[model samples]
Every structure is written in structure tokens, then in C-alpha cells.
Target: MAGASSRGGGDVAAAALRRCTATAIHSGADPAWSSRLTRPRERDGMVVVYGDARRRLERRATDGAPAVLRRSTAEEEEETRKKVTGGNGEKGEREWRVNVPVVGGHAGITIVPLFSQAVPKANLADEDIKAPTKRTQDGGTKVVQAKAGKGSATLSMAYAGALFADACLKDLNGVPDVVECSFVQSSITELPFFASKVKLGKNGVEEVLELGPMSDFEKQGLESLILELKSSIEKGIKFGNQ
Candidate 1:
């Protein structure tokens, strides 16, 4: 078992898996299996969880960015209320958080954040939508640059891996409706694999949810990302076969 980022991490893992006989458990930003694991005889339960998507949404909410949604504890809510109302018991605007479902492969343009489908509606202007979308896509690059190329987003990647593992455990223990967005072998789109909301259960992925409705902006983002994602998947498969 190992954790890695999406950029070339999955491709390397795929090649390594090809040389081994044991079942491998990979937790990272991309679905490392590619076409190999999608075969009927080689099928194994796997999921790609991108934690940066959630982190970016959290940053936006805390920064008072518009149309963001949040999940907060009662104590945190009370503290926010006091700050917003100036502790004068006056009603003021409340803070919110965003839940953006990230799809496609985990890479530069391959990462797609469906802000229009965000919870509580990210009702952002076109420019606003573009900003976060690009940020989500280039998040790993930004982290690398910030550290002067010393390391990647190892901490955040670890957190996302742990979170997904816990979800898988709960589902295996009979937890119902344990839903999470994951990159898996999907028929929801023309691509062989895609990232979308999925219901996890004892047998692994019980249901793959549809992308639902998409705003024009979101639709365009999805369309533009497919070619690059397909190329990356194919590249991984080629490496595995070599």
C-alpha cells in the first residue's frame, strides 16, 4: 500500500502492479488501474479520492468568498455568528461552505470541478466560476511551487487517503448510503473511467450516480477535459503493458 499524487503517480503504480502477483491497495488522487483493472477477470474494488477539491472549497468559505457552502459544528456556528453580528445580538449574513464534485482524471486539465452542481448552488459569475475551477485543477502544481519544488502536497494527499479508507471500512461494516465522489470504471460517460458520486456498500461500488444537470459553463469544462483525460489513461495503460 502506498499513497501518491495524480501527476504520473498512477502511471508508475500501474507499471509496478503489473510485475506483482499480490492484490495491491493504492490510495491517491487518480484511479491507477486504468484499462487493466476494468477487465471482467481483473476487476477489483478501487476508488480515486481527490482531497484538494474539498480543501479548496474550505479555503473559499473561510475567505468569505461568495456562494460557498460549509459543514460546521454548533460551537463553530456560534462563534461565527458572534463575529458576524459584532457580539451585539444583531442579525447578520451567515457564512457558508461549498461542496464541489470533482470529476475526470486527476491531473492538470484532467481535474474538473462542477461548481454549478455545488451544494447550496455556487451561483457565481462566469469569471468567478473559472477562477476556482482553474485553481482546483492546478492545486498540486501550486503546492509544489510554494515549496520551491521541495515536495508535493503529501499532507493533504495523506488526509484524503485516510478519509476514503475509513469510508470503505464503514461501508463494509453495513453502513448504508455511504456516498462519495470517486474516480472508478464508469459507463456514465464515453470515457472508460470517470469520477462521479458513487454509493459504496459491502460489495464495493453499489451505484454510480449520474452527473445530473450541468450549466453551460460546466458542460464546456467537461467537454474540454475529456481528450486530455483519455490521453492520460491511455498513457498509463501503455506503461503497464511494457
Candidate 2:
């Protein structure tokens, strides 16, 4: 009789939890924040943050220069980050340790790093993450900007496609701690799930850590980000499915 009663109580607790979760979702609240006060685990999110490489964005944010000039600056910076030697040397090897995330929906200014909430934490600078974010976010406009009577940067499109293939290849080779930040459906947000950091591997993401604790700066950033991220997500879903 006691065992049966305990089981019934457990079911009631579970049901209440589900209802509460649904309510939070319906009301547009990030449930993770309320679920705890301070989390100690260092988690990774759905975006990769590298170091220094994002210097291109620093210029864009400050540029009084024309949009085309800003884009030109960004392109130069991106080119600088790469190391090419494939056809040039057969005995030579080139590897890039730069971090990248497959963030959902164009990888724009909404580059929400799921770093702390992701499996493995990658050390990165704000510029590193932010620059790529701007590129991803504004890539559509970039295409428009570059196509001045001429065709376009079909080359850029192909490069991204091939980069994705390479990332997949490396992860398949049992590369330890292969990671990419991508938009993933998760229990982390008010919505069903949102984009964040995810660790890539031979079998895809093995585990997703919680978003852990945030510094005051991060907390404030997150507060500012919620509305924007939410709006973007809604826009995508509406446009894509409808």
C-alpha cells in the first residue's frame, strides 16, 4: 500500500512539472534561469567563440566608413585568418584551430554561445565570436552589396559548403572534443528549444550541459538578447513553415 501511494505521489509531481513547464513556454519565459540560482558546471553553448580573429567586427562597429568599405575590411580580416597550402605542397600540412559554431538561422548578431551550456568550453574572445556573427547575420546583405553589376560571391557560398563538409569529416575521425555551435531544439529556453553551443563528435552531440552561471556582464547580455532571439526564432518558423 505504501509503495503504491509513493508511486501516485511521484506521478502527481511529474504532472505538475509538465504543466508548469508548458505555462512558462506559453508565457515567453526562459525556464532555465528560474530553475536554479547558481550553477557551477562550466557549460558550452551552441556557438563557438575563438580568440582575436573577430577584430574585423571592431572596425565595423566603429566605422563611419561606407558599408562597402566595412565589408571590404571584414573580407580582408577573414582572409588573414586562413592558411592555404593544399595544392601548393604535397608534403606540407595545414590545420586551423579556430573555433566555429553552426548556429541556427544565418549565424547573425544573435550568436548565442551555448558555451557554458555546451559540452566542452572553448576559450574565445568577444571579437572572435562577434565578427563571424556579424558576417553570418549580415551575409545576405553582403551578397547584395558585392553584386554590383557583376554576378556575386558564389565562391563564398561554395566555401561555406565545403567547410561544413570538412568539419563533418574531422568529427568523424574520432577527433577528441570536436565541437561546433549550432541552433538546437532544447529545454533551455521559453520556446521548445533555441540555438546554442553543441559539441560535435562521431555520433553527433553526445551531451548538452546546462548554461551554468553567468557573470554580471553575461547576465545583462542575456537579458538584452532574449527578446531579439525570441523574435528572430518566431520569424524564421513563420516564414519557413507557413
Candidate 3:
């Protein structure tokens, strides 16, 4: 991957995104992969970005990698990811670790990372996709289940926390159109809600790229989602404004 393209860790992606703001910098090749996304940070030249994305994606499975945070110390991040989907299962039972990145600010339903567009794009319905997607979405639920009705979903959630953090890192490191179906400010609907495939760059959120055309089911889902999304945003905004 050397000689491809790279940048230093701190807000490198943001620096690249600022290029488009220039009054005279209007060519097309400007790091316009979707303006405003940030690149990954570098440390000892290890490239933590890839591992982050991989873990983020893996979090959906019952076994997600250890937790790594977007804005936390490295030691804390790794410690977190390992906590969940950990302990070799209960009673020292062997449990496979599958990392899954649940992007978007944490919130039930509000958080919407796209599993359909995952790297290879697993051909799965909501249920099949749900297995991972839902598991990730409800990573909390899994934790509660594993807790034996004790504490709460802590470890696994941390794993997802790290994966998402890493994905953002990778995108910023000149990762060539690093695409993650994250749930950020988007235009898939009129709601200003979450969708996927946002091109990460120098900024925290480079571009809110389209979700392409929706299938009939997807279209219906989008339609309904917008209504709910709009309502949610309006309520949040209105409440915040007040």
C-alpha cells in the first residue's frame, strides 16, 4: 500500500477536505470523495484503521473484537474491545469472536449502520442480516443475555465502539474511498436521518453519499423510516431549541 497515498494522524482527513472550500480550487479531482470526512490517525506506522474497520464489521457477530474508541486512549480502546465477546464464553466456554462496527452516535433505533453494504455485501434478509445486524443493533440485548441477569451489556458494546472508531481512522488515512455504511446525517430520505456508505475523509464526515436506488421493500422502508426519522429529528431539534 506504500506509494499509494497517506497522511499523518491528527485530522489529516479534515485538512484534505478543507481544500474544496478554496474559492479557486474547483477542479473535480479535489479530495471530493464526499466532503468533510476525516482520515485515520497514524501511530508507529501500524495503520490501526484497517483493524478498526474489520472489528467494526465483525461486531455484528456474537463475537465482536475488543472495544476501541474513536476518541480514547489506545490502551483503553483495545482493553474495551477485548472485554466483550470475550471470556471464551461463560464458564470458560469457547465462543467465537466476531467483530461488528455499530456506527452512529449510540442510540436505539437512532443508530443506523448499513449491514447490506458491508465490504462484500452479504446477501441477507433482515433476519439473516438481522443475525449480525440485529445482534449488533441489539448488542445490548446480547450482553444482557450473557450477563445472567447481572450487570448490563458492557463488553460487547465496547467492541463495537472500537470498530466504528477504527473505521473512521482508516477512512482518514488516505484509505482510498473508505466506505462504511454508517448512520450519520444523510439524504436517503427527507428526514435528515441515517443511511450508509458515507465516504470518510479528513473531516469527521466527508460525504453523505446516496444509498443509490431503493428496492420496492427498501423504498417502502425508506418511506416509513423518513416519517419516523423526520418526527424524531423534529422532536430532538425542537426540544433542543427549547
Global lDDT of each model?
0.53, 0.37, 0.38
Best by lDDT: 1
- By TM-score, rank the candidates, best first: 1, 3, 2
lDDT for each residue of candidate 3 in 1-242, tens digit (9 for 90 to 100): 00111223324433333332111111111122212222222221122333343233223211222232222212112221322222122324233342223233333343443434432333445544433333334554445456554544444434544465566667556576765545455655555655455676755567877666433533444454455455545554553354
For residues 139-198, write the lDDT of model 2, one tens digit per residue: 534554555423433455445434444544566666776544344567765655454455
Over 1-242, each residue of candidate 1 has an lDDT whose tens digit, in order, gives 22223344445544433333221133233323222233423322222122333333234333423332222111001111111111111223232333456777666666666767665454555666676667666665566567663555555554555556667767767889997777777899999877778898776788999998877877888898888778656654554454
The top-ranked prediction according to TM-score is 1
Considering lDDT, which of the candidate structures 2 and 3 is the better prediction for this target? 3
Candidate 3 yields a Cα-based lDDT of 0.38
Model 2 clashes, total count: 24
What is the Cα-based lDDT of residue 45 in candidate 3?
17
- Model 2 TM-score, 2 decimals: 0.40
Provide the lowest-lDDT 10-residue window in model 2: 21-30
Q: What is the lDDT of residue 215 in candidate 2?
A: 37
